[model samples]
Target: MENSLEFAQQLDRTDPLQSFRKRFYIPERNGKPLIYFCGNSLGLQPQTARLALDQELVIWQQHGVEGWFEGENPWLSIHQRCKKPLAQIAGANPSEVCPMNNLTVNLHLLLTSFYQPTPNRSRILTIGGDFPSDQYALESHIRNRGLNPDETLLEVFPRPNEHTWRTEDILTAIEQHQNSLALVLMSGLHYYTGQVFDMAAIAQKAHEIGVPVGFDLAHAVGNVPLKLHDWGVDFAFWCSYKYLNSGPGGVSGVFIHEKHHGSNLPRLAGWWGYDEARRFEMTKGFVPMPGADGWQLSTPPVLAMAVHEAALAITAEAGMEELRRKSELLTGFLADGLQETATVEIITPPNTAERGCQLSLRIKTGGKTVFNHLTGQGIIGDWREPDCIRLAPVPLYNTFEEVWRVGQAFADFTS
Candidate 1:
């Protein structure tokens, strides 16, 4: 635990998941692997991803149009193959998980079903400074329902000079707007601050007020432990490219609680959502498939799903609990190391339970220049606007020595 290279190397030697690092293709600069600390943005590609993609390519070349039903992994039911693994990752029933469209697209689709606004209870409650795509999707969806965003969108901001929201304040806001709150949309982990929200408690509080709750787990999924079904979350969606390690622009996954799956909840349905039994019959009425598959709008992208399959397989083998334990240690090491430096502030929560792997650093001055220096040294991390740099020590592929190197980079830059 000492702030020394030997200590860091010792920790890496004893890490249970150290072998996982070999599964990913780490990007290099000048013939050496960069100290990658940006898995929260986009994950490093899995070494098996190419093989997975190639399998599908071979299927396409051999079978062509018949590939839908005549292949080792048929295109028709490829999405279903991902359900069990995705469910394990998100802590939901296989029936409740569906691998489908992109994150924003899935949000719009899920909103169509869950974001129902009555005359009196039409406002949507969410946190401020959410991912821009989420904000855009929520605002546009509200406007689509003939509602004014300013009046219908209720955003909770952290107190002045604060970096994260307090759970008490979030619950208080929910109580105050219970009557007018139509939906409670929040992130499982804040992308910028790296603060984890009490999603289960938040969902319970919202449900007590008769408000439907959902979460965007873009930053949480694969990085943190989640129990969507146990939490009674009405719905949730996340992209696969981050901690999930699917390739860039990977297909996203959705979780619809079992309670809503059988309901006549309104959704923007498509042929893919139709009952598989009657799909070939070309039925007149749209009979939705059971569970989350009922929410899917189109045919699955086999290549993308193949990549997800490869990535999810890795997660399934490693297990979330094991990965999370390593994540806590890795981030904790980074936090402790950063605390020794004077020029930067670690804004992420000190408690391991309140964060994933990301640590958001606020540089006192020359933030971008310092970031550039880190990059030049092959220490890769993401720079957020204003003056913050985000670094994620991903448990699956990142190591303790890498965290030490980053701490050293910061000290060198500041000194």
Candidate 2:
């Protein structure tokens, strides 16, 4: 307690955005603040979220039917209004983006539009350790096409002595399977290991081989700078709960490069994707909106959109370049501190450019013991299945002092 209090004092002295901490609801036990380091999972709620949501609630109560058209935030163009700032974060044009369903659902929708398997080339390639949701989506998509996953789905893995696959190895896998690849799908940043993959290089190589490339940016969207359209990625999807600081199960987004916007692509049709000009004409068939907005399947969730809009405004306000600057400094500070702890090894790559706000620490000894110790002491970081602890110092809300404190907590646990 003494050490934690002293660390808190030090943090208070040096934190640049420390005032931002008060903008969130901090979980507590017995009237003390519990240290939160799980922004990589679900970010703390923003203070503005409630106000944004309530603004709509008031409209709903005062003018039930009119609110849909005349509300302060009109339900009609609500989704459209969110695109510009989100596009800024995604490195895309407004027309190339849309906020729709959850991450997995959006991935499935994108596959329907982009993953058209031909007789000779019907396989989808993914990384070996992709998130389970993505794995299942890929397997199901292949099976639905009357293709066997065992034969059609290829997985690229790390070499014999490595815990993480190198960029070169992944590119080699793409080359080896190029002849039969219908699509090359990958996570922009790995979930478990916290390694940011080289999206530009991977996309370029896959395109060279005549295979379309897509990505699940659930961990990368707000954590790193992306040049999605410039990289020539066919499509991408991301959830907003993590680094973007929208609440749990908040809205997710998708991107479709402009090149495919006018193509005669087949997509799962829904009323939401119908052209807005004639949407209320009681049309019998779907008329798709151009660009990524064509993928929408249902009415937009206004409350969720409000929460995301608030967060996106904050992200655009802070600017990715600035957030990334703080992120590199804060994560590197944690990495440096862990090295001196003498009982932990960082599994994630050491290069700041190769990662985001997270550091995956493998405790050589007292793994769970250290995890539990931190928990008991009111320091909260997440632990993966067996031995790794994931610490994310979100640039918007986390401070360098917190990084040092978490480090000392590890030292105390090791001792």
Candidate 3:
């Protein structure tokens, strides 16, 4: 691969997914789209999102309360309609997926059922430097059970001077604490370093130790391929606002393995999770809807679900395998270009399978200065605390030309 503008243009010319870029509303500066490499943060809005929202609004205005059963897409089963697509993205049976509460809320709900702790097996094993919200949620959950976080929460961190956790170390920690470990919760992809964890291997190890495993896939879903059902994961949760492109603070999704669907696992149930067929009967006892739908709480937000439906449709049409193929090429191209530049270290794993679209650059010096320069020049990457810049060349909307331009900006700043 030549480090030339023509090379970038050629790659763009040959990219099968290049046309998908037009489906998004990229931010502009002086009539040109900014080089957006922050899909790992908030994704750009889809072009069809407004139409999707307007359709729901129209249904609301015309049908009023009758909208529940009186529209092309009925509100009563709006979330049920999302299950199949969401399941496709999660690699689960449609019965095993549900779009409902926000990410952390869903986490707590799943934990309520899965994180049953006894006197001996009471500790939760998780990786260190997880998203702050997860850390807080775990601590709160432990505290609610009259347990101390310091004693009940076991966190694994990277070795000295390392940016990501090793698979061996993670397995070792799980083995060492198997007696006390009640649940294993980890992120499918590390948010800061963009390293993809070996979720299947971890799940196998946790199951071997008689502990259930779950994943916080906030940064993984829609950014990479997942097989939660086949991996035998107990449960998982993720947000749609980032790589899923469902708007800011969009509705989140959850997955429960088919094996757990009809079992007598105790869940924090609500009216919505009640059996849909018998829900209107107003029965005294709770009969949970089979599968992940049993975990849903409140009524689905129609407007947000409208946006999610539109976004997931786009992802479905593009297909995850194709998206991942382009993602690997796009990120690899960026990595190669960044290596030729100076003053920044690529901290993400070089192996394509060990990462998704994001690259974490550890700036050698003047980190904020370089970031500001790139921002002023209309390069849209995010800056993490201390000294990292996270950039993601999202395959659905980003082009090779954009990757090349970001590389050139880094070269200019470092030069």
Candidate 4:
């Protein structure tokens, strides 16, 4: 590769999607706004969000109850409107996807239906280093089933002294407890390390063991290309606040493979989850809509759906494949630049297929001083416990120049 600094500058000048950088709210340090490379946590708000939200507000004011059936975004069908684009993003059939509650809430709803633990196979196999919310969700699911979380939940961690878990080790664990494992739940891309797990392989293996597989795609949904249906995954959930460019606490989505469309499983159902054709009838018994929409427990939030539509409209315009193409270049540029410097060490996997736009760095001196230094300069990468710091270059809005600046900032700190 060319010299790291020169290459970063060159990439910036030539980036086809570089013009998108001006569309976000970059924070100003002194006069100039600092580079944002933390889209893995909460993505920056789109500049178009205001207009989209305002349109909804105006309709609500002008129409009142009539807004439910009328407006640019009719309240009753807003969630359904989001389903098509979200399905495209997740690589699933539109009937298999739905946007509703937040990430953990959706997870609970999915687990309530999908996780049917029997006597012999009551255990859940999850990654050792999942995000705290995922861990909590698993614990709740296990306990809610009248089983002990510690006894039924198995967390597979990396070998001692290793930075990330290996695929071989994970598969080995699955093979060992194949009989007891009822579900294999994992993050599509790990939050701290940014390691994109081999979901297809894992799901294939889990299915062989008769174990249903689910994934939390919070960091992976927009950051990497997903094929949940083709991967044979039974179910999956994701938050839009990350790489999807949806604002913080934005609506989350879930996917249930088309195979589960008419299954007569007992789900925690509500009015919206009932068949839409009969939803307003106040019928005697609950009737479910096919696929993931059956998981919704309450009415759709039109305001949140508007925000999701606005953000996803941008993603839809910039096709996921194209976003991924820019993402590979942007993240590759950041990785290439940082690896050339001696002071910074990347904890995320080096292989492009093993990671997304996120790169987790462990400073030579454990991250304390370096983290403070970067935040002081108005750079907004987050620090995890211990020494890891995560930075993400969101292709939709982050620029190649910002990636270079972040590298320079890290190089300066380490030097």
Candidate 2 on 1-415: residue-level lDDT in tens? 1234465467556656567666777778899977788888998888999998998888788888787799456888888888999999999999999999999999899989889999999988899989999999999999999989999989998888776779999899889888888999989999888999999999999999998899999999889999998999889999999988888999999999999999988899898898988989977988998888988999999889888888888888877897898788778778877776777889888998889988888877778888999899888889997889998888888777777778888877776
* Model 1, span 1-415: residue lDDT tens: 6888999999999999999999998999779998899999999999999999999999889889899999667899899889889999999999999999999999999999999899999999999989999999999999998999999999999989988899999999999989899999989999999999999999999999998999999999999999999999999999999999998899999999999977998889899999998898886889999999998888888899999999999998999999999999999898888887887998998989999989999998889999999999998899999999999999999999999988898888777
Q: Ten consecutive residues with minimal summed lDDT in candidate 2?
A: 1-10
lDDT of 4 by residue, 1-415 (tens): 4535667678778877777766667766779777787889888888888888999999989999999887566798888888888888999999999998889998888888778899999999998878999999889888878999989989999889888989988898999999898889989899889999999999988988888899999989988999898999999999998888778889999999988888876688888888888888898888888778888889877788888998887777777898888888888888877886776789888888898999998877757888889888778899987888889888887877777778778778767
- Candidate 3 error regions (>4 Å): none
Clashing pairs in 1: none
lDDT (C-alpha) at residue 55 in model 3: 96
| Root-mean-square deviation (CA) per prediction | 0.8, 2.5, 0.9, 1.5
Pitting candidate 1 against candidate 2, the one with the higher TM-score is 1
Give the alpha carbon lDDT tens digit for every residue of 257-333 in model 3: 99988688878889999999999898899888888898989899999999999999999889899999999999999
User: lDDT of candidate 2?
Assistant: 0.87
Query: Which lDDT values do the candidates have, in the order given?
Result: 0.93, 0.87, 0.93, 0.85
Off by over 4 Å in 4: 4-6
lDDT of 4 at 101: 89
